[model samples]
Target: MWSPWRIVGESLLSVAFGLLGAGLAALDHGGTVRIAAAGLAIAALSLLRRTLPASVLLVTAVGSVLFGGLAPLVLVAAWSAGRRIDGVGRAVGTFALAYVLNLGMAVVQALPHLSLPRLVFGVLWPLVAIIVPGLAGRYRSQHHTLTDTLREYEAQQQRERAMIAGQARARERQRIAQDMHDSLGHQLVLISVHAGALEVDRELTGRQREAVGVLREASVAAMHELREVVQVMRDSTEAPHEDRTTPGVAAAAAAAAEDTTALSRGVAGIEGLVGTSRSVGAAVKLRHSGEPCPLPPTADHAAYRIVQEGLTNAHKHAPGAPITVELRYEPDSLVVEVANGPATRTTDNGRGVVSGGQGLTGLGERTRLIGGLAHAGPTADGGFRLAGVLPYTSPEGGIPSPEPGNVTTTFVDPTNTFWQQTPGDSLDEGAPVMNGNGLKELAKAMSRKNGSGIAIGCGMAVLISLLLVIAALGVGGYFLLNKAEEARIEPKQYDTVKVGQPEAEIRKQLPKENSFVTDGLETDAPPVPKGAKCLSLTSTESSNNPDMEPVFRFCFKDGKLTEKKSFEVRN
Candidate 1:
C-alpha cells in the first residue's frame, strides 16, 4: 500500500506530464478536437503507470502513433514498466511489444511513399524514446538494491565488533577476581594459623588468650567471605577448578605467597603487620607524619598492599636488613613508603623462597584502580624502596561506598579489556569461531566483493544503449538535411520554365517538391489550367526574406506544361 505522501507526489507528477502532453498536442497541425482528445487520454492513462505499467505502456505507445502528441507519455510509461516489473524476461518482452507497435504504425503511415531512410528513421526514433528510459530505470533500481545490501552488511559488522569487545571484558573481570582471591585468601589463612598457635600458649594471661581467639575467628570469617566474593566475581559459565596443579593456579599461588607473609590486612591493619614482623625477630619499624585523615576504602586497601609488598620483598631479598614503613598524611593524599637497607645475611638460609615478580605488578594494578601511583626501585643507599601515593578521594570520584555493614573488597579493573583477549579464544555461543586474522580477512573480503561487479555491468549497458541512440540520430539528421537541400529551387530556375515545354523536360530543370516548406502555400493562387496536374517547390533565393515565402507552381496537361506561376506567400 502506498502512503498518502507518496500518492500525492505521484499524482502531481502525472498532472505535470499531462500538461506537457497538451502543449505537445498544440504543436501538431491537427484538428482541435483530435488534439484535445489525445491530450486528455494521455493524462488519464498516466495515473496508472505505476500500478499497471505494462497496460499503460501499450496504450500510450498506440496513442503516440495515432496522435503523435503522446510520445513523452509513452517514454514515461516505458520507464515505469521497467521499474515495476519483476523479472528481466518480462520487462524485455513488454518493451519489445511496445517498440514493435510503434515501428509497425510508423511503417503503415509511410507506406505510400516509404523509402529505406524513412523506415530506418522510424525504427531509430522509437528506440531512443522507449528503450533508453527503460534501461535507465533498471540501472537505477539495481543501484538502490546494492546500496541497501551494503548498509545491512556494515551494520552486521558493527554488531560483531561490539559483541567481541563485551566477551573480552568478561574474561578480564574473571582474571582480576582470581588474582584477588589467591592473594588475599592465603594471607588470611596464615593469620588464622598464627593466632591459633598463640591462643595455646600457657604463659599468656586469660585476657591475651581471649584476644588471640577473637583474632583467629576474625581471620577465619574473612577467609570465608573472600571465597564467596571471588565466586561471585568469576564468570557464571565457568566451573571451579578442582585440580590445583594447573600452571595458572600454581603461578597465582606463588605470587600470593610473596604478597603478605603474616596477616589479613588493610590501612587500619598496618600497625599489627609491623608488630607481627617485629615478633618474628625482624627489625621492622612504623613511622607517621602530618595529620591523619579519612580515606576511601579502595585507596586505603591499595596503601596497605604497597607496604605489605615492601615487607615481603625485604624478607626474600634483604633478610637481615632494617626495614622502615612510613605513612604521611598530606593535605589531599596518603603517601606510603617502605625501605630496607642492604642484606647482612644470605637469602638462601635453607628456606627456598622463589619470587615470580608478579607481586609488584599486581600491587601497581591494584593501586591504579583507585587512581593512585605505585613505584619500586633501588634507593641511593645499598637498599631498595617501595612507595605509593593514594588520593584521600579517588580522582574518579572514588568507587561507590560500600553499603552499611557490608565489606567492599571488590576493586574495579581500570584497563581496557577489548584489546586484551587472546586471539584464539571463543567469544560465546552462536558467534563465529574465528581469530583476529580471520576477522580482518573477512572484512577485507566483504569490502572487495560487495557491489563493484553489478555497478560496472549496469553502467556499461546504459553507455552502449546511449551510444546507439546518438549514432542513430546522427545518421537520420544527415539524410534529412540532404533531402531538404535537394528539394529547394532558385528564382532564375523557376523563371526559365516554359508553358509549352514537355512535362518531363520541365521536371528535369526544376528541383524536387519540398513538402516541408510548400505544404502551407496560399490557397488563393490562380486556378490551374483546366484538367491539368500541378507541382509546387520552394524557392531558395526568396527564403532569406522572412516577411514572404516564394513558391513556383507548374501545371501539366496532355504530357506538356500548360502554365507556370510564382507566388509570394505571407509567412
Candidate 2:
C-alpha cells in the first residue's frame, strides 16, 4: 500500500498541485509565508496519506480552510482516505467535517459580498470535491483487491500442479524399486547360495578356495546393499537429513547407510574396481595418496556410489578407454576422481548404450545429500571425467554421537536359523522339490486367496446396479403418474356444440366416461321436461366417488338438441 513508487508519485503530484495553487495566490497577494506553508502542508499530507490517512485528511482539510493555496491537497487526502478506510462510514464522516469547515470559512470570508447563487456554489463545490474522488478511490481499491485474489488463486493452482507432478514421479520410482527388489534381488540371493556352496568344497585348492571366498563375500554384500538401495528409492521423504535432530532419524539414517556399505567399507574397493576394468581388456590404472581415515556411513556410501557410477559410465560410454582412478584423503575431506582417455576401440553394443542423463542427475542428488560435491564432464583431450569430494563428518552437521536408547543394529548372527547350514540341503537335493500334486495344491491355495477379493468386487458391483435400478424405477413411476394426471381435459369441445345440432352428434363430441374436466360440469341431466325425449351430454366424472354428482346439464328436446344448461348435483 505504501511502496516507494507510490510515495514518489504522490509526492510529485502533491508538489505540482501546491506550486500551481501558490502561483495563482501570488497573482492576487504576493505573500512568501503563505506559499511556503501551503507547500509544506501538501507534501506532508501526500507522504503520510497511506500510513495515517484519517489524520492527514483532517489536517489537510483544516489547513485548506485556513490557508488560501492548500485546498487541492484536501482533495488528494480525501481520495486516499477513501481507499484506506475499510467502510464508507469513516470516509463519509471525514468528508462531512471537511465540507462544514470549508463552508464556514467561505461564509466568513465573503459574507458582505456573498449572493444566494454564490453561497450555493461554494457549498456544492466542497461536496463535489469529496464525493467524486472518494467514489473513484473506492473503485480502485476494490479492483486492487480483486487482482490480488486472482494472483493468489493462480499461485495455489501452480502449487497443486507441482505437487501432482512430484507425486507421479514418486510413484514411478516406487514401481522401479519394487521391480528391482522382486527380480534382481532373487537372482543375487541365488548367486550367494551357489558361491557359499563352492567356498566350502574340500577338493578345491587353497588359491581356488580363496577366489570363491571373495566371490561369496562379494555376492552376499551385493545382495545386502541392493535391498538398502531399493528401500531408499521407495522411501517418500525427499530430505532425509532435515530430520536428523529428531529422536530416531539419525539412527535410521545411519542404519540405512551401513546397509548400503555392506558390500565394502570406506575406500575398500578402489583397487578391485580397477582390476575388474583391466580384466575386461581395458587399460586402467589406480592411484592413491594421503592416509585413509574413517568416514561417517553416509559419506562412505556417497564416495562408493560416486566411483561406482563413474566406472559404470566409462564402461558403457567409452569402452576400451584408459581410465585413471584417483583417491585423495585430505584432512577435512575425501576426494575421488575417475577420468577416462579417448576410446581406442568402441563396440557396437557400447554405442547402443541408453543414456537419458538420469544417472548423472541421480549422482548429483546423492552427493548433495551427503554434503559432498560431484562433477562429470568432457575432458580437453576428447575424454570424459567424473569427480566427487565427500566430507568425513555427517551431512546434517558434525558427526552425531549415538544417543542412549537411539541405537538400532541389524547385525544378526550368521549362524541363525534363517541362514543355517542344514545337512543334505545342497542345491541338488533342495532344487525342484515340488511334484504335480504339490503344484496343484499350491494353485488351489492361490485361487482360494483370490476368491474372496473377487467376491467382494462382484458384490460391490451388484449393489451399485441395484441402487441404479431403484432410482430408474422411481423416475419412471413419477413420469407415468404425471402423464396420467395430464390426460384430464377441459371442455374446449363444448364451444363447438350448437343449439340445433343432433343430440347423437353432440354426445359423440363429448369426452368418454372415465375422463374428467376441470370445470364442475354435469354429464347427466335432471328429469327432462314432461315426456319429451331427452339426451344428456357428459362433461366430467369424479374418480374418487363417481356416483356423487355431475354439475353440467346438456339437454336435447325431441331428436335434435334444443338447449344446453347445467345444474349443480350434490350428494
Candidate with maximal lDDT: 1
Pairs with steric clashes in candidate 1: none
Kindly list the per-residue Cα lDDT of model 2 for residues 273-362, writing each as its tens digit: 566556546677788889998887666756666666677677656766888889889999999999998876544322133332345655
Q: Across residues 108-133, which tens digit of lDDT does each residue of candidate 1 receive?
A: 98776676668777888777778877
The alpha-carbon lDDT assigned to residue 64 of candidate 2 equals 66
lDDT of 1 at 401: 27
User: Which sections of candidate 1 miss by over 4 Å?
Assistant: 1-8, 29-36, 193-205, 235-450, 511-536, 541-558, 562-571
Residue ranges of candidate 2 with Cα displaced over 4 Å: 1-15, 30-52, 59-68, 85-89, 99-124, 141-168, 190-222, 231-571
Report lDDT (CA) for all predictions.
Answer: 0.67, 0.58
TM-score to true structure, per model: 0.57, 0.33
